[model samples]
Target: MKVREKKRPFQVFFHDNAVDSYLVTKRATKKVVASIRAAYYDNSSKELDARYRGELLVYQTVKVRQRQAEHAEKFYSVDDDHCDLQVDHGEATKRWCYYFENISVEELSHPMNGTRLR
Candidate 1:
């Protein structure tokens, strides 16, 4: 059988809440923060670190929290799945439940070429 994909069908929000050196390392321009060690709560399965794997939980947005976080980023692929997911199950309304890899500020600045998820 074909192996199941581990990544979520939706995109994720990257909030840097002074949680660790994540802000500092993520801010280093022209460099790659290779290992983004994070704990994604409210989720289960091979979805994450084995410590919190396979929990398979999801929730809705009751509210939004704004912070004056000096270093924060909404890590998203411009070539994203905004138009693919069910309208009622909007990815924009979720929180703290996914991962982003091999991203950089420079890449975010330019427009991507191909259509997404084709």
Candidate 2:
């Protein structure tokens, strides 16, 4: 018998550049964001981490509250059903950048070429 994995809601944060990409329209982006929020609020089991090179990088967000000594920072893992976001490592900068444009639910459901959608 195979053990079943628990499903849980997860959060996704888009990088500033990813949100500004021309390949992603405001309407589409809004839809995606809404879906994620709904899933999380609904308590659905879904990983929220972005995937690259067979590695899972948890999505993280840092929040700072005014006049508050403690701020909350959270990281999320992507659902197995959702396509992990693609990323590229900058050789010059030694940093990782994620791609968000041209990503469709279909693509997320089924990733091809292990690369960013065109």
Candidate 3:
């Protein structure tokens, strides 16, 4: 004889709309980039006691305005919980012994303003 089992999957919903936001900057010159509409947030939830654990879903929308043109785009992504643990006592000891034998920033010099603006 055999027994039957039930299983459930995760659910998600995504939306697209203009998300109003702003960018604030402070320096010698104070400026506030206002009315920069971008991707907005959507509702998200997960089952607390489901058959599966360590699952995530994310939704985002973005807006682009170029030369009197505007458009909106939506995106979705899902991920799972993963990690690794290891033991390397010998390697750790070797790394700690050479920690202070590195060079300082002042001992090296490089050029700036060499990058071209796209």
Candidate 4:
């Protein structure tokens, strides 16, 4: 017998925050400063290290995050019978339930392309 299974989906949350080394004034104190590091890598592994200035390299990092989110969902239908025809009573209903619960266009395309929903 052929076996089929369902898959799970996922999402990624990228945090984009940078520190400015210039100066913060409160109407009373004013100071000038320079950037200590040209660039640095964050925990996300998305940021470049010592290769970029402020915000100039953020677009590249955002693209990485977008790609990651595009392939996050996972799930699949069981078989042809379970997905297409209604053969019997119990099997038909059971398969229908499974089909709705797991089967989706995204899941179907993922295996072939290794990603979900473009």
By TM-score, the best candidate is: 4
Q: Compare candidates 1 and 2 on lDDT and give the better one.
A: 2
Q: What is the lDDT of residue 88 in candidate 2?
A: 27
Better of 2 and 3 by lDDT: 2
Q: Could you tell me the C-alpha RMSD of candidate 2 in Å?
A: 25.3
Model 1: residues with Cα > 4 Å off, grouped in runs: 1-29, 34-45, 48-53, 59-118
Q: Lowest-lDDT window of 10 residues in candidate 4?
A: 1-10
RMSD (Å) per prediction = 24.9, 25.3, 26.1, 21.3
Off by over 4 Å in 2: 1-24, 44-118
> Rank by lDDT, descending?
4, 2, 1, 3
Model 4: how far residue 54 lies from native, Å: 3.3
Per-residue C-alpha lDDT of model 3 across residues 3-115, encoded as one tens digit per residue: 11111001111122222211111111121112111112111233323334313221111222342243223222222123222135564445444443554324446666668
TM-score of 2: 0.20
lDDT of 2 by residue, 1-118 (tens): 0111111011111344453343435545556667767877555233432244213313222222432434222333332224553232242122121223223322455446667667
Off by over 4 Å in 4: 1-52, 74-79, 84-118
Residues 1-118 of candidate 1: C-alpha lDDT, one tens digit per residue: 0111111111111343443444344344213222222222323324543543333221211122223232233333222344443333345334213314333223666688787885
Give a tens-digit lDDT track for model 4, residues 38-96. Answer: 22224334543435643556776788888888755332324565355444557656876
The C-alpha TM-scores of every prediction are 0.12, 0.20, 0.15, 0.23
Report backbone clashes per prediction: 6, 10, 1, 3
Report residue 65 deviation for candidate 1 (angstroms): 11
